[model samples]
Target: MTDLISENLQNKTGLVIDGAMATELEKRGVDTNNDLWSATALIENPEAITAVHKSYFQAGADIAITNTYQANISEFMKMGMTKKEGQDLIIKAVKLANKARVDYFRLLHKEDRDVRAAHPLIAGSVGPYGAYLADGSEYRGDYQLSEKEYFDFHRSRMQLLDKAGVDLFAFETQPNFDETKALAHMLKLDFPDQHAWMSFSIKDPETLCDGTPLQQAIKYFNIFDQISAIGVNCTTLENIEPAIKNIRAVTKKPIVVYPNNGDIYNPETKTWKANRQAETFTDLTPKWLDAGAQLIGGAVEQHPKTYNK
Candidate 1:
């Protein structure tokens, strides 16, 4: 396998990842507040999932991170869905993104008559175990699970997404070393042909949510060849530059950074505080790129309109 995504990311600079899928879904009137989060729309409103993907393509996204963030089998089964149904939904998430890419390409070719309009890639999203807990441990990263437990939780989803044929894996919003290490090892040992970009949610510029230094974590993660890019996501705007600098100093891999919309996430309240306008986020893009982020965009509070800016 050629690993087309790694090739594309290596060849392209300033690659624009799509903004928040859940935020866009909420904007379109989908309630994303339950344990299932955005993944609920997979069963209740799948068309809405495809619609968000289309909006991001229209907004100039170079990659569509699939809406499988909260679509794990165990959780779906708890919601009265069968194991097969959950797997089918995960596969559907990838298919919807691929359909949007095909549809967008048709429009682009008809309008511009150019093949150079950055062919979009679909990245299958694998959110951390905390996202399943829905207790905000994704930002805290202090889970008490063993590596085997972590693997058992994530492997089914990763396997299903792989079978669905996404262009790459996005092991994103991880906040601890154990989960990251376990997932990285799983990918290396089980799916060596595929590549993934692992991003973390940090407590600050230097520390991950688990109190591990970003550089120290990167040093361990960078040793894995299956991890194509290493960086951060769902972090604050102010911490991005310093965080990227720390990662950049240690690894030669492509760096990806997608911070929140210049707002503070109150884990206790389960809401964003003091959300700023898109312009505040747009202003920070240049600095993040200047700090050496190859793939940059926004998470949660960001919309495609913001991505367009």
Candidate 2:
């Protein structure tokens, strides 16, 4: 974890990343009914997106993930946007995170003595190929595409995200070993300077959704220099501990974990079946840290109530 932190995010100990950008946006009254989800806020209400980022920063998040989880050109074209317009929106997602970080620091650090607050890092979101499908495939992860095909799907958007100057990348909620390999290889070959973390959406503690063994996947991906950390996200809370312990047994690289609010997601319905096992992120943080997650936070439920102010 210490090795993965850039010079900007000075605290290497236990950095808190912000939670669901889309959920916070919906809380702020952004309409998120379409296939585009929160990315629509980037076009319809960008300030609300930035406000979500600011709220997380104010709430003590050390890193802010840009609102590009579902931002891609293929979907934009279906919505009647040109390729250029889609690319611009992707770039705008990163800009909003930067703007929010600036505003957060300026508003909170008006005096030099308040410089104790470290500038939060921006992580460009790279949701899996299933996210573009919008059929709950991100959690399923069986894209059935070849390696080259998966690489092709990710290349353009990654280049634009890098060009937009994000401090790092967050490959969140990935479900298959093949696509994970493809994306990791893409970063190694094409975007050598960029550092990214890959978090999978697992089916159980030991297995990925595609039925690959979790230990085998981490052992292979953890060696890549560009692939900074490996772990799980968008999964149930009960599944996180066993997954983290299994990951730690295989590799010493930083483990990053951001599970969902313990709800079951139905891809066909595109809705979450809430679970009673849900615990506040604060209550779960120590357990996750003790279990071996270096970076810890919430997703889908890291709402306005989680904020301090």
Candidate 3:
């Protein structure tokens, strides 16, 4: 097993770092704007992404997600790139992460730390289709595609990411069972060596959009041995409690939970922001950990200091 997954199995609490937009922002000389997932594909600077990963490492994060959440062909087609071009991005993404790992070890060694002797883990992030797959919206959805098509779409990227040597294969922001099954199967077929984990999104609805109960969804996927953990992210902190509670009822596998900024106060607009005022690293993490969430992280609006705080 890779060190990342092994540590996750050992350390009950694994920290997640999301720096999707770090490269894009640095290229344009801007800070993060939209959700990092979309804003990240704008810039192509692997070095900038590495620096952000380093910051997350310093923040005490055990796992750092590469900035390739939207680096799939279907998503990149919007940017006018061909399928091959988008696929090549994965190789580059892996190299970028390896660079981040090397740099992080160098920094730690300089500070008299032994992180180099220990193993480090890098996760290659796979975000949902730019549109929903179950019930595709007119603009974002492109729902006409069949389930097999969706699976095939993601399959191409999975193959490339597997070759890149990511410690695990991660599917994030999926809202239903169709997505979960399709992705899990593809990963098993192509990247059997890597671990697979799923994260569902919380909308206004009670159950996830695919209509599976939280526990059932996890139970169904647990049949696959490669699933090291199951949890949720990119949603409200309020959702974390219910997610943890439900997921805990089903399986004993490690639980990973990362909530977005929860109820933040906006200075200029005088408004409370969920993603805007999202949870800091310190706030509410203890609640999740105490509540049996084996892993903790910041989803939307995640900063490197989230681990430090």
- For lDDT, the strongest prediction is 1
What C-alpha RMSD separates each model from the true structure? 2.7, 3.2, 5.1
TM-score of each: 0.92, 0.90, 0.79
- Which regions of candidate 3 fall more than 4 Å away from where they truly are? 1-4, 11-13, 16-44, 110-117, 130-145, 204-206, 263-280, 299-309
User: Tens-digit lDDT track for model 3 on 1-309?
Assistant: 553664644633444545334433444455433333433443444556666666666555667776666566665666677877777776777777778777766666444343221356677777776432222321122233457876877787777877888888777766656667778877677676778678776552235655556677788887887887788776666778777887888887777776556654332332344455444655676677777776566643344334322
Writing each residue's lDDT as its tens digit, candidate 2 over 38-80 gives 8999889998988888888776777788899889989998999
lDDT of 1 by residue, 168-260 (tens): 899999998889999998998788888899999899989989998889999997678778788999987788889989999999888988888
Rank candidates, lDDT, best first.
1, 2, 3
TM-score of 2: 0.90
lDDT score of residue 53 within candidate 3 = 67
Error of 1 at 8 (Å): 1.6
Q: Ranking by TM-score, best first? A: 1, 2, 3
Per-residue lDDT value at 213 in model 1: 85
Q: Local distance difference test, per candidate?
A: 0.82, 0.80, 0.62
Candidate 1 positional error at 90, Å = 0.9
